[model samples]
Target: MTDIVMEAKNVYKTYGGSSKKADLKLVEAVKDVSLQIRKGDIKLIFGPSGSGKSTFLRCLAMLDIPDKGEIYLGDECLTKPGVDLNKARARIGFVFQNIYLFRHLTALGNVELALRRVLKLPKEEARERALAALTEVRVTDCANKYPAQMSGGQAQRVGIARAIVRNPDIILLDEPTSALDPELTGEVIDTLRDLAKEGTTMLIVSHEMPFARDVAEEMIFYDEGKIVETGPPSVFFNAPSTDRAKKFMDRIIKRTTRE
Candidate 1:
């Protein structure tokens, strides 16, 4: 059997609840969601804006705690409130849409800092791992450059290198290419494809349809905080089981052809 790296069971998460009548209403971001990510699986999630895909990814990464249900990393419980999470969290990596590199730090320094501080690797070892990671993303040439000095793509590559320096069991990305121009976006997509080929398990929430269809082992269509359909790209892209999925594909195709 393929090993599962992360699993969610009936997970639920909400935001912005208040007793006051004038206050914003509660938003159910994830509702009764359950899924498993197998080792080395490139799982792609697609949905419209505010469809809860990003929220679910954050819950998996534990950046946003779920209001109900359970999450597991391997055999250990990961979502129990107040549980010791350092070890569980250490095994996961996350890259966000907004590349959050410290402007003062060089690309190499940014990656090395995560290795030394979070993983507590020795200085020399961290340097070696950081450089390897930079090379993996083809950002080695930008290692000594600061974030302000690099293009959007280069900065994001550094962000990815920092995320993978420790070799986490699974990497989570939220709209990694949504902000880049076509040329830069292609580079990021190429880097991600290389990682997938190298057996890095990933859960990606993206609108890059072509890349998702090509790289994903499984694709999920989420709507209103629920997974409407899940299948391989061959089925999801060509023959979606749900009307919502079909409509989504139609809209996307129309938009692409128009552009």
Candidate 2:
């Protein structure tokens, strides 16, 4: 009924508080964020550390529960203050900053396990799907190779393949290229672009402004657990429309100039 592939409304999260210290206030990670991503969007969540950008992305992906808010994937309510957690989670695929493949399992095995175990897919079907996903990521040659034998970029691509194998409605990437060299980063970025073009909605948390500029259809800047600005990359980068976003972009500019 809607074009939105994902939605997060009035979401909130916090940390660093214990029952022993009721007076110890929670460090808010996300504050009443309400955002939407249309189907097939490649959206960027970019901001300085502790700005709550990462937390928002995680909550959108269903990896982290929102303390208060509602999330919807398509017509389905995944989270509504409290709701069907399993169904909503099933529609999301999460990728982390570090690739955490099972060392004992070969690349193929790692991808296959998820499909077989979680999805309850038959062996043959799981193998076919896993191989195709790996090929899409251009890591088919390394399918039989163990994670230890692969480079960081290769491992990350495999991580992506694992994510796509589930064929989830949304892919959540947490700094996918933060560890790779420039050349390797290019490979992964290209793979990501292909997925975006294919209409797999994705929300990425990244500090790579150049890549974000190239890949994102929309950009959101967060500050102090709040979304400061959301707009197309052209506008967000060129004209931030807010003091906080302007200051954030200034820092990005400085970082780029120094590097």
Candidate 3:
């Protein structure tokens, strides 16, 4: 058996209980979703916008509370309804589409904040860790720059730096390259691939299909809040089992093979 680092069982989430008109509908963001990510695996959860991909990632990161189901992080239960959610959250590092950083803090400060407050490390130690994280993303030169002063890619590097500085074994990325251009996207993707090589477990919800095929050890196609197909990249891309995957590939070709 693969060394499992994270697992989600029977997970479900609903949003929007009320509507402006009386014909309100509760959107099921995630529906009975279950999957396991092995240690050192780079797994991609591919889905369209509003397909619950982000919500699923947030639930995995413990940034959002799930309505039903159980989540396990290295044998620790995350969703017990009344369990201590903070402890569960501390174990997963999260990076998002938008780089959330303090406007006044430098890139180094952004990465060091969590180390200083959450990890309770001394200032020098935290700064050293932050520097290492920035170096990992090849953005150590931007350490003293503010978020507003840096490029989107540099800001994103800082975001990744902040997430990894905690040294969490599992990193959850939520559409991390959604706003980045191709060049910048490649930079972060390269950094992530290096992390995967170093044995860090990663769960990525992304739209970049080619990157998924190249970097992910395995991938799942999510639609209507369900995983319709899942397998290694070769099987997922070349021998998808379901019609949903076929249709998805068709769209991918239509978009990519366009003149």
Candidate 4:
């Protein structure tokens, strides 16, 4: 039995070398990035835009294949060949920045689809679980509403419900609130806070400093395709060990304060 829910070892990813342009350089979006998340851990990754945080997250979820290194969900190596990736992915929930709800389906339908299709739950069971998940995210009122009918916050909450309905071992959230309007951000944050209180194991790529400071057990500072610094939230809020992290924190804090 292992306490580690997920682990990444020397994970590497690149892009753009396949372009026809001769001068197009290979961009290393994730360079030898390694991370470990234990049960009930809430770790936050924050850095400059286009720094490959999202790429690393996608690799962890096995949504994007890594060029080098290994990803482990518990003891199972996801990057290995012949693995049932679809089965593995079903155990790992992923919430994207853009709320990718199915426009044709209502909120409940979006959540129930995975249960019925992937998990193969009975129709009545799927509906019950979907409604429960929506209630957990405080979006039960949006159950019958289509994506186009809900507010941004409600839609994102539905996306979260879709992610969590399967009761995956861990949830990987990429900039969960970044796409929402500033005022709407709080509702999503509140849902996340409730999830945190429930001890959900989460690895989130977010810049929501206030929420991070309040809920994250560890904060990782990533930049230039590598993890530059990592520590408890106090280390980043007070004084980061690395100059790069310090400068980044200063810029982010200043911007947050201004907003």
Candidate 5:
């Protein structure tokens, strides 16, 4: 049997609230979404703006809690509201689109901080792991450089290194290349592809179709808080069965051609 690394069941999340007189609109960002990710599987989630892909990713990462549903990392329950979130978070790495390294910290410092603070490793051991993680992302040369001294791509590599240094079972990426220049995105994508080859299970929120097609085991088409389609790239890209999916693909094509 395939080992299920993580699973989300009937998850629902909403935002916005109301006072006594004011009617606050509730936005259902994630709607009864169920998903399963097997060990070493790379799943890509794609959608346009306001499609709730990022919110869904945050829910998976436990950066945000769902209003209702259960999230499981193997046999451990992650969405029980009062559950030990720190323990759950330790098992999942997260790379955000915006690189938020400490301004004063060098690349090695940024990565080692996570190991020391979250994993509680000794300074010497954390330093060793940090270097290994930086080398894995091919950013060892930038180890001594602060975020301000590095390029966008190089900084992102350090962010990735921070995530992987924890040795989590899954790594969640939120539009990891969206903030990067078209040219600068290649290095980060290369690192991600290498991670895939090394059997790092990942769930990525992205619109970078070419990278997803090449590395993703499956693609999920999420729009308006729901999954419109889910399948291998061959099926989702070449033979989308839903009208919503077809229109979304058309939009992607138009945007790509214009660029």
Candidate 6:
């Protein structure tokens, strides 16, 4: 088996170029970007707000189809014409920034939905697995609670449970803690830290510098829809090679310290 769990090659995605709006210019959200995540790799991508880190992540999961380039999940090239994206996505877990849990379902129900529906597991087995996932994320106490009843931290942990219930090859998180209150962020970050301890392969777009420094195997500095630099956390913290990365780190670190 290949060491690479996921790979993106020359991926490009654009929007509004052909739109009829006279004032709208084309937006190249992901421009010729390529990345690879090997087994048990924890890579963090960080940059300015509108730099397209989330877009690139979506393209990696096939949630958004790229206009050009190839995305590979292990040996399967997901960009191929006849590939089954649903199956491909099943092996990949995605945690959104906003924590989109189903309002109607209890936390367990939300997590079990995929195992029961998509994976076609039996009822009892799905429930057991769902409970186990909730326990793993430290959200088992919220299993019977609906999204509306849970706190932001609890809801996000449930969201994580839902994603990991399927035992995906890797988890792609888009600023998982950004939507929560500052006080609530710690619980979520702790859960992620636990996952890191267990060697989960994750590609996270997060600005949590402490978490990144502690958990990430490599840090990628992305900007303007392109990767400006990539290196270990120590390299970025001490000295980034590129001027852009250095400047960005200075600004971000100052802001972080202020906060």
**Which has the greatest lDDT?**
4
Error of 4 at 53 (Å): 0.3
How do the residues 1-259 of candidate 1 rate in per-residue lDDT, one tens digit apiece?
A: 4499899999999988886667778899899999999899999998889989999999998888899988988887788767778777778888999999999999999999977887789999999999999999999999999998999999999989988888898999999988899899999999999999999999999878888778998888998999989999889768888888999988987886685
> In model 6, what lDDT does residue 172 have?
97
TM-scores for every predicted model: 0.96, 0.92, 0.93, 0.98, 0.96, 0.98
For candidate 4, lDDT tens digit of each residue in 157-207? 999999899999999999999988898999999999999999999999999
Residues 1-259 of candidate 3: C-alpha lDDT, one tens digit per residue? 5478899999998887876777567899999999998888889888667888888888777777789998888777887667777666767789987888899999999999988887789999999999999999899899999999998888887898888888786899988888988888888888887887788888988867777878888888998888878889888677789888878877875775572
- Runs in model 4 deviating more than 4 A are 18-21
Candidate 5, lDDT over the whole model: 0.91
lDDT accuracy of residue 183 in candidate 5: 84
User: Least accurate stretch of 10 residues (summed lDDT) in model 6?
Assistant: 16-25
Question: What lDDT score is found at residue 16 in candidate 1?
Answer: 85
- The 10-residue segment of model 2 with minimum total lDDT is 80-89
Candidate 4, pairs of clashing residues: none
RMSDs, each prediction? 1.4, 2.0, 2.0, 0.9, 1.4, 0.9
Predicted candidate 5 versus true structure: per-residue lDDT over 151-244, tens digit per residue:
9999999999999998899999999999999888999999999999999999999988888788999999999899889989988777799988
- Write down the TM-score for model 6: 0.98
- For every model in order, what is the number of clashing pairs? 0, 0, 0, 0, 0, 0
Q: Candidate 1: list runs displaced more than 4 Å.
A: none
In terms of lDDT, model 4 sits at: 0.96
Q: Tell me the deviation in Å of residue 203 in model 5.
A: 0.2
Per-residue lDDT for 182 in model 5?
83
